[model samples]
Target: MIPWIELDSAAIPGETGTLRLKRRGDEFSIMLGANELMNSRLSGSEEALAELSCAKLAGRKAPVVLIGGLGMGFTLRAALAVLPGDARVVVAELVPAVVKWARGEMAAVFKGSLDDPRVEIHTGDVASLIEKSKSAFDAILLDVDNGPDGLTRASNDRLYDAGGLGRSGRALRLGGVLAVWSSGPDPRFTARMEKAGFATEVRTVRANAKRRGAKHVIWLGVGHR
Candidate 1:
């Protein structure tokens, strides 16, 4: 049987230890503590997020999209696939190591998203970017932390909180959408979105199955900023 091999490592601010990237053959996994943040085989939730978020920006000018995390660049690649030539993507990733892994070791997995002209990588907390931008994005896809219930970073809770959602609402242009990827469902987060005045929809998608099985949830929280 093949075993997981340590391929790369990087540090995230506020994390107790370094984030490790491991590989078993062609597949890869991201590890923080004992948890597997994500794997290469099944990025359905991320793809779903990019798809739904981009749907909201159809026909918008320049169509600026903000992606809160760049995990393997699946979401970004998916977004770039559907977005028009004039569209632009701003990705905020908190961990510099993660960025390095994506640019260096994980480059093949990312499929050249880093070199795309429309991409702008910001190495910082996504919240700060949200707070600083003024109605900038047509879509905000947040894959940082594990949805509303964060596991890797305690500070990520703010991104799922009402106050954070409010800031995200303010960061988008009118009729923009906020899509959040979750390993599981959170009703309270949905309620928070409702309270923040978004027309929300919960989408369940499978990692590989097209018909539906072993599904993951993506909360599509649509709002008019």
Candidate 2:
């Protein structure tokens, strides 16, 4: 077995703990204390977060998408693969260290997705962007923290609350998609989405593409027109 090596560690902005970047051979992981926030090898659900949401905008021209987290760049890369050439993708990452890890130690994991012509990196809170915009995105994909029951920061809880769901709905265009990736299910989250005027579907997906990993949840909500 290959030994895991700590590449670097960085404080998670306002969080008390720091994120540790570890590498084992070709694999990489981002850990917040004991909780593994993301892993390069387990990206099935994260990819689905973008795939499921982008599927909702099949006919829209130059659709704009906002991705709330850039963990391992799985969602962003997946979105770029299926979205039209003219479409734009804005990725908001709260921790600057995560961005540095993408460009530095984990560049291969990202595969140049950061430099894609249609993508932009916002080094700030995704919530702020959601609050400042109205009907600004065709799809809003969130893979922040550990879903509704967060781990990294208490503030992340806001992104799953009723008020946050309302903000997400307002940020999206009518009939647009709001896709959220979670480590597990939260029935209350589904209810919140529905109350926020979105027709919602809860899906359980395997973490790995081989379909042999932990069951992760993805909430696909289409904003009511």
Candidate 3:
């Protein structure tokens, strides 16, 4: 096996562990110490996430979107491609270092998402952004800390809990969408979204456009229309 080369490390705001970006040959991984948070190529959930959230309103007025997590900026880049010119993309990344890494070492992968006119990168908990806003966003995509189950930071649990989910529901306008990318299915989570009064749907997408395997799930909670 080849050794993983250390690419960079960033300290997460209000969190103990630092976000580390590493690479081994062509394979890349983002980690918080021993735990691997996300793999570059294999994580197609983000693409699906951006797609699901942006759907149904592609040509509408300036759509305001909040994306939690800045991993590789794949989701952000994808969203930019699909959204209209007037759309606004606000990315809330808990770790400032992760933002720096994305701007530096992973610059090419992110391609201009950081400097894009429609983008606003916030170095704080995404939950805070949801809590502070009131029916402000057209779509909200939660790709932070591995779904509802938080492994890297204990505080991340709040983002998937009852209060966190409720805040997300309230942050959206009527018919606004809330999309979450999980590694696998979680029945309890789907139930929670229903409890929050969202017309929910659980969708599975391929890891890559050409690959064949069990599809990756992306949960979408649509608010009242």
Candidate 4:
């Protein structure tokens, strides 16, 4: 068995914990403490997050999409694959190292999604971006933290709270969608989306493309017309 090689480490801005990038042969993983934040081998659910969201915006010309978090670029690449050629994708990632890893050691995993002509990378809090806009995006895809429960930063909880949901809704254009990825199901979160006036659907997806990995959850919240 090949031992995992630690590529690099970075301190999560608001948290004391450090994020480490490791690789075991072709597989790569981002770890926070002992928890695996994301793994290259398990991206089915992430891809689903993008696919389902883009599906809702089918036929919309020049759709503007915002993706929070750049984990291995799975969601970004998936979104790019399905969106119209003229669509624009803005990726907001809180950790600079994650972006660096994508361009550095994990370049192969990202497959040039970062360099795609339509992509714009923002190095800051996605929540701030959400708050700064008013009906600006056709879709906002969030894969930040583990889920609504959040593990990396305490402030991440705001991104899943009532105010956060409200801001997300306000940041989206009419008939827009907010797609979120989670490690597991959260009943409270589903209810929150409804309370925030989004027509919501929760989907259970496999972690692996082969369809035989731990189940993950994705919430698609359509903005109320």
lDDT of 4 by residue, 13-100 (tens): 8889899999999999899999999999998999999999999999898999999998899999999999988999999999998998
| Per-residue C-alpha lDDT of model 3 across residues 1-225, encoded as one tens digit per residue | 999999878776666778778988877789888877777776466777897789856666999999998888888988998999889999998877788878777776777778989999888888888999999999999888666677667887877888888888889987889898877889999998899888999998876645554467788888884
Which 10 successive residues of model 4 have the least lDDT summed? 145-154
Q: Rank the candidates by TM-score, best first.
A: 4, 2, 1, 3
Candidate with more favorable, higher TM-score: 1 or 4: 4
Q: Is candidate 1 or candidate 4 better by lDDT?
A: 4
Mind sharing the TM-score for model 1?
A: 0.95
After superposition, candidate 3 runs with Cα above 4 Å error: 212-214
The most accurate candidate by lDDT is 4
Superposed model 1: Cα runs more than 4 Å off: 209-213
| Candidate ordering by lDDT (highest first) | 4, 2, 1, 3
List ranges where model 2 is wrong by over 4 Å.
none
**lDDT of every predicted structure (CA atoms):** 0.86, 0.91, 0.83, 0.93
Candidate 4 Cα outliers beyond 4 Å, as residue runs: none
For residues 45-73, what per-residue lDDT tens digits would candidate 1 score against the true structure?
67878987788777787899999988888
Q: Model 2 clash tally? A: 0
* Prediction 2 TM-score vs. true: 0.98
